[model samples]
Target chain A: MWKAEIKVLLKKSVLDPQGQAVEKALSSLGYGNVQDVRIGKYLEVSFAAGSHKEAEDQVREMSERLLTNPVIEDYTFELVEV
Target chain B: MKFGVVVFPGSNCDLDAYHLVKDVLGEPVDYIWHQEENVSGFDCLILPGGFSYGDYLRCGAIARFSPVMKSVVAFARSGGLVIGICNGFQVLQEAGLLPGALYRNLSLQFRCYFTYLKVENRQTPFTSGLEVGRLLKIPIAHGEGNYYADADTLRRMEANGQIVFRYATADGEVTDTANPNGSLTNIAGVCNEMKNVLGMMPHPERAGEAALGSQDGRLIFESILKNWEGAR
Candidate 1:
């Protein structure tokens, strides 16, 4: 079995509106050195695959098609034996 | 012209769209369930607002994979008119029918209000009879309505008049404060490069009649009707 940990974030050039709001809240609470903040999503997916390379390829396909929106977001994944 | 409104699993506004066409506009309309693959016998297609696929992965992302979408995409490619409103707009972006994507509101709030819109391009069938820079009072309800496109794509759209509407002051100025959702260039609506497809974040069906508080929205439907009539 293989487990995939996926992370999705808004493109660097795209505005992270919710992240900005959280950053502002942090600063007002005296966390002045917060610098910047960006929000992202993490997903844990497990499945049976022939090999780790096959699992990685499958995860890549999933991310490119459904897990992320190419227009506004980007995604990356890491696979491990479970 | 007959209309077909696609009803996906989570569509809440399909009935509103049907009412707008059948009861309000006095036109023939039909409901196309999400699983169906055929979209014949309809001149125009409407994708109404609501959370499809429970908006699980992303708004419109999963819905784009619906069986009916294949036919809708084909219809659009054949130059048939398609109107996507609110969540429908998000679906079109996912379906690649229209340019750009919508993001969460800058204020991180679901906004529901009667906002002002400026007619950006009046030459297209959707706004042919409308005056340029006309101010339209329309209601918008959504949490993710901030429109964004790459600078190059936006420039091309500008040159081709793909932009159809922009949030504006009642006096017709496109200013920072007039923007409700922080959309790039105050964009509220846009058409495909061919001008056959339009995706907008406003709820035009909700504002279709005076009893609903404004009749401005009816013009969009009427425009589509006339376009169909004029073609033949």
Candidate 2:
């Protein structure tokens, strides 16, 4: 079995309203040094795969096909043997 | 003309679409279930607004994989007319039937208000009866109606005339002050490259009658009917 940790984030060019709101809340709490904040999703999955190479490719495809939207979001994955 | 309004599990606006078509528009319409796969024989298909699949994972993410959406995507690929409203618009974007994705409102609030929109494309069957640049008052009800896309895709969509509607002032000026949801470029609606599919953030059904506050949305239905009539 292989385990994968995936992170999905809105593209840098796209505005992150939720993140900005959180940033404001943090700033109001006295953390004024914070310049910016961007929010994203993180997911972990365990699946059966033959090899590390196969798992990496499969997870990448899954991220592109369903886990992240190419138009507005980007995704990255790290795979490990379980 | 006949219409099919797909009713996903949490679709609150299916009935609105059905009532608008059958009672108000005086046309034949059916309520299609989310699990159903066939979408044939309908002049147009509507994916009504609501939280499909409980909005799990992401807005329109899980619902994009629903059984009916497979057929909806197939239908749109074959040049069938499909209109997605609000949550439906998110589904269309997630299903790859349309361009761009919706983001949480800039204010981080679920906004329910009347917003003015400018008709950007009169060539589409969905807007053929309406004049380009005409301002339409429509109600938007959603937390994630702000639209976004990469710069390249945005440029291409603009050049291709895929941008169909933009949030505008009452007097019809597209500006940030008029953007209730903070969508990139103030886009309220967009069509696919083929112009057969449209995904809009506003609820045209809700605003289709004067008693509801505005009758500007009626023109979209009228435009659809006019197109069908002309084609037949």
Candidate 3:
């Protein structure tokens, strides 16, 4: 089985309102030294594949097609065989 | 002219769109199921607002893969009119039929209220009835309606006149305070490069009747009808 872990975050040009709210909360808790915060999504998918290369290709396709909106977001993934 | 409204699994505004076309506009309309692959015999198509696919993964992400979308894309490419409202706009962005994406509202709140929109481009079939800088009172109800596009894309859209509407004050001024979602440049609506596909965050259907507060929303539909008739 191959497992793919994906992380998606809004591109730098796009505003992360949810992250801003969280940052405000942290500041209220005396974490004023923190520079910034950006919110993102983490997803894990496991499936049977022929090889690590095959798994990597599948994960990339999935991320580009549905896992992320390339217009406002970017994604990174890690593939491992189990 | 005949109209078809696509009904995704979670579409809640399908009926509203149907009513606006059939009862209000006195035209023929039908509901097109998302699972169906064929979309013919219709002059225009509408994708209404809703939490399609339960907004899983991301808003409009999962629903964009619906079978009917393939046909919708082909229809748009063939120069057919397609209007996406609110959630429909998100779906259009996800499907790559429209430029840019609707990001989470800057206020981190689901805003449901009346907002004034300034018509930026009056030549589109969807806005032909309005004059430049015309103000229309429309209501927006969504959590992710803040429109975002890269600087280069925005510049191109500006040059192409693809931008159609912007949040504005009652006096028809585009300003930050009038922007309900902190959208870039107060953008509320845009059209594809061909200008046949329009995607907007505001719900014109909700404001189509005077009893609902304002009938300015009808102008958009009227514009489409008038322009379509002119083209024919």
Candidate 4:
């Protein structure tokens, strides 16, 4: 079995109000040195694959088609055998 | 002309759309279930506002994959009239029927109130009854109503007159203070290149009757009816 770990985030050009709000909260909490904060989603999916290449391909496809919205978001993933 | 209001599992405004068309406008209307694929026989389809799929994993992300959306897409491609309101707008964007995406409000709050909209494009079938620069009082309710499109896409949409509505002052001044959701350029609504498919954050159905504190929204239904009649 292989587990695909994915992180989805709004594109650099897109505004992340949630992230900005969190950043403000952190600043108020005395984390003034933190210059930036970006909020994103993290997911872990475990599935059976014949080979690492097949798992990687499936993960990439899934991320593109369903896991992330390309219009406003970008995603990165890593696959690990479990 | 017949109207079909699609009913997704979490659609709370389906009845509002149906009531506006059937009761107020005195037109034939029906409810189309999300699992159903057939969308023929309806002159127009309305995707009403609500928390579809409990707004999980993005507002309209999961709902865009509903079986009925496939037929909706085909219908739209054939030049059928389709309107998506609020959550429906998000679904349309997710399904790639419309351009751009809605993000969380700049204030990060669920804004629910009456707002003024300046009609930017009167050529769309949905806004033909109104004159250019008309000011409409409509209610918007959503946390993610902020519209955003890349600079290039925004330029093209402007050139194509696809921008249908914009948040504005009651006097018809487009201003940032009037923007309820902090949408780019204060955009309140937009349509596809063909102008057959429209997606808007405001709830016209909720403002269709005088009892609702505004009858300005009735003009939208009237425009649709008038356009349909003229075409037939």
What are the models' TM-scores? 0.97, 0.97, 0.99, 0.99
DockQ of 1: 0.85
Off by over 4 Å in 1: none
TM-score value, chain A, candidate 3:
0.95
TM-score of candidate 3 on Cα atoms, chains taken together? 0.99
User: Worst ten-residue run, lDDT, model 4 chain B?
Assistant: B213-222
Better of 2 and 3 by lDDT: 3
* Model 2: colliding residue pairs: none
Query: Each model's C-alpha lDDT?
Result: 0.92, 0.92, 0.93, 0.95
What is the docking quality class of candidate 2?
Answer: medium
Which residue runs of candidate 3 sit more than 4 Å off their true CA positions?
Answer: none
B1-232 per-residue lDDT for model 2 (tens digits): 8899999888899999999999999999999898998988887999999999888877888889889988999899998899999999999999988988898899899999999999999989999998899999999999999898878899999999999999999999999999998898899999999999999999999998889999888899999899989988
- Which residue pairs clash within candidate 3? none
Locate the minimum summed-lDDT window of 10 residues in model 2 chain A. A65-74
RMSD of each: 1.2, 1.2, 0.8, 0.8
Model 1 residue B229 lDDT score: 82
Residue by residue across B34-126, what tens digits does model 3's lDDT show? 999999899999999999999998899988999999999999999999999999999999999999999899998999999999999987999
Candidates, ranked, DockQ: 3, 1, 4, 2
Candidate 4 CAPRI-style tier: high
Which consecutive 10 residues in model 1 chain B have the weakest lDDT in total?
Answer: B122-131
lDDT of 4 at B125: 98
Tell me the deviation in Å of residue B178 in model 1.
1.3
Give me the overall lDDT of model 1.
0.92
Show what share of the native A-B interface contacts model 4 retains: 0.65
Q: What TM-score does candidate 2 get on C-alpha atoms?
A: 0.97
